[model samples]
Target: MSADESSQATALITGGGTGIGAATARRLAADGFHVVIAGRRRERLDATATAINVDFPGAASVIVMDVTSDASVREAVAGISRCDVLVNNAGGALGVSRVEDGDLAEWQRMYDANVLGTVRVTQVVLPLLRRSPRATIVNISSVAGESVYEGGGGYTAAKHGTSVISETLRLELNGEHVRVVDVRPGLVHTEEFSLTRLHGDQAAADKVYEGVDRPLVASDVAECVGFVVGLPQHVNIDTLVVKPVAQAAVHKLYRAPIDWKTEA
Candidate 1:
């Protein structure tokens, strides 16, 4: 919730504790934005902020926010004096239960976290964002938002809601100066993402990236965000879909061991 004395533009990232969120915080800080790293875990938020400050020196702040809560989002954004960029990076998948066997509670958790969470944060922060000459809102969605598989019904449905909202908001704010970007990433190999989705099954999580030649990392998506936000306000990238070379589509993936060290 802090900004620099220089009145630097502020970039607020929800779920900034780890993964692509943490990486985005660092990339934006290096690019000269006072980054507010917000998440539910104080330790993770502090760590991301500390890492940013190490190289950029007071370029980061931490806000403990649970995006699923209205009160939390309100209190968290209320403390910020200014917000030039908002990254809706919170929310995660809880399980992969098939449609017929889906747990109602798990479905609700996925929906609340991925869809409603984005809505809550954006609603409170719009006023501050309007103050900036060139404000930007980036929603970190997933390729699942665009497609559906057997066991991915709940997560995909929630992400589709996210995708729809981003599109709807962009249209609603047509004349407004704010830029809305929907970033969709596929097959990213992160420490906690698959593990959490598989309900702490480390073995299953590890299998998610097995034999894939360098599935996209957090930094890869972070770099995409950096580029999108850095662009001139006049040029708006409506939607960006990013995935590893091994993944041609959500259903298509080359999972064999790939050796790129030698000649083809």
Candidate 2:
């Protein structure tokens, strides 16, 4: 890609290997922005970029980055020269335990990934964003940030911190060129989110959405992000909450009986 082509517009998405991050990369590329997909998984990032490039040639690339590591993030971001949009999507829940029974190490890891990760990546990219004529920052938060439930203390706390970052950054950059958008999604059933949260316990992860018809998928959230970023610069969606109809709130899930024949 040449400098003139890159000047078309650029978007850098963290956690871009899988789930919402990957989906958002595709959406942004389709919207005519050069998309930089970053994550720790090199193969996954490459695959995502490949798919995006097939549809929107020369519009996608990959950068292997671990948002949790300060050095790794700085090094990965150093190569990027421009950013019209920054999607802070590299975050996850670590465990499922109450506050008293929580593992201290897991709690710390959650905070590191979900909160500090956003801060680290956002800080490095803000300068690039400012250089764009119309810049926007999309922070992928969770409904957990807005409300809590049993055994959700640690993840909830970290998401709350993410919410705080979006709110505070918007205020601090009030007259600045960038727009801060916070997207809170509920009951999003990404391929790896629940499994990772349950420490690779498949059965436990399955139970998280068992009997639910259809939870929000990665593309669904990506659509929201794409829509928000494509809006006119003067239009800012400060906070948007998206949830499956089966989920009225964090604790309120309408479950249906599973059909064994259908599964078979």
Candidate 3:
């Protein structure tokens, strides 16, 4: 095969139906990649694929996939002939609960989604990635992975596991010419994520952003992925931490000072 044909990169992104996943799919397709978007929602996946196809023309496909299910991940990866890029982006918090008051079930759910889900998808797609001359894996980690916050113990622990996995995978794949990249973003405003954590409490979800002027949007993170993926084959960005200007850290945010004259 010619270099162009052989190097024609294809990207398979998990949770690509919405949020950062959808944004990444659109960005990747626009960057001339043949994109395959996978997620649990067939309707949303179809919509994302259609939108990308319309915008980029012959650059998008959709697959119904549940990352937490091994069988589902196996089937999805088996169907793909090649994958130059695999973005493990399907993960979120369950609820904000203190360790003492945390529900074991909720913690388990977070672990399954954030840790096992990533492993299942990566395990199935590694072979296809290895087949390519230039392959890259981008794991969507979080700032919480690096630090703990009040009422974030369960979710933070899971993300910490994800961070460790990404690091270990990089070492394991060192000789295989497969690049591993981890992007950790802080305070991204995504509907499904907050909604899930709050258990469909719209008011609770809304409160998450009430005072924030601008938080990191899905597109912001997506652009970072695009930049990493577009780098030369020899260049590998191991880890990138992105956050909004207002966010200093997990517990630090620039809030408006309390004042009587401040508009409510």
Candidate 4:
């Protein structure tokens, strides 16, 4: 799309303060979209918006929002005149625990954020999206949704919900000129996500990447999102699964051999 076309588009991204959300905001802004970054952290949101404005100049805004709250979602959506694109990226794992020994509170939190949060934001934004000439909705799911892993009970289930919602919306919005796409990513390195899953244990977060040659970064996923959103309005990418070269699948990965690099 040309700069003139991009300037006419408006995109709203949830959880835009950090990680994949922030990366998507930056990518979209670079694409010439008027981007709005929404999240609960006011300071982080301001920082992200400021960085975008300084770098991209008049391409971004920040909205303080909590996706889990209906009022917050409604207010945030209401503030925008028209939403050309909606990115549901404000969800994450609460904790890593077996189902039997899991904390019910943690499970509930995951459901509220991962499932209901997406629902709330989508609900508020649909009307505005419908008004756009070429509208698109992208939901950030995970590989965990397609395959279960140990200690991923709550998070996997929540992501599965997101995947289902995306599929159903695609069917419902078939002829509405609004495309719904789902992007499921494998292991990604992000501070807030790993920190929350490990219950604020920084060491646990660090250990997740230990011994791996390299894992997928937030910007990688953001690039995938941008690819989907940048396609022709008539072209819709239903679903996309992205992973690092080291990650083959949810249950399988090719870790580096200890002595191979040294020998080479």
In model 1, the runs with Cα more than 4 Å from the true position are 1-6, 259-264
lDDT of 4 by residue, 1-264 (tens): 235434578899999999999999999999988888999999999898899989998888888899989999888777778689999999999777898989999888889988999999998899989988769999999998688998999999999999999999999888889999999999898868898789899999988777677788899999999999999999999889999878888878766743346654
TM-score top scorer: 1
Tens-place lDDT digits, model 2, residues 1-264: 468656779899999999999999999999999999999999999999999988888899888899899999999989888889999999999887888999989889989988999999999998888888779999999998899988999999999999999999999999887899999999988899999999899999999989897889999999999999989999999999999888889988989853445643
TM-score of 4: 0.93
lDDT of 2: 0.92
Our tally of clashes for model 2 stands at 0
- Candidate 4: clashing pairs of residues: none
TM-score of each: 0.97, 0.95, 0.93, 0.93
> In model 4, how large is the Cα lDDT of residue 212?
70
With a 3 Å backbone cut-off (N, CA, C), the pairs that clash in candidate 3 are none
What would the per-residue lDDT of candidate 3 be over residues 11-106, giving only the tens digit for each residue? 999989999999999999889888889999999999998999888876888778898898999888777777999999998889898999999999
lDDT of 2 at 181: 95
Which regions in candidate 2 have their CA more than 4 angstroms from the true location?
1-5, 257-264
* Candidate 1 minimal-lDDT segment of 10 residues: 1-10
TM-score: model 3 vs. ground truth: 0.93
Candidate order (lDDT): 1, 2, 4, 3
Q: What TM-score does prediction 1 earn?
A: 0.97
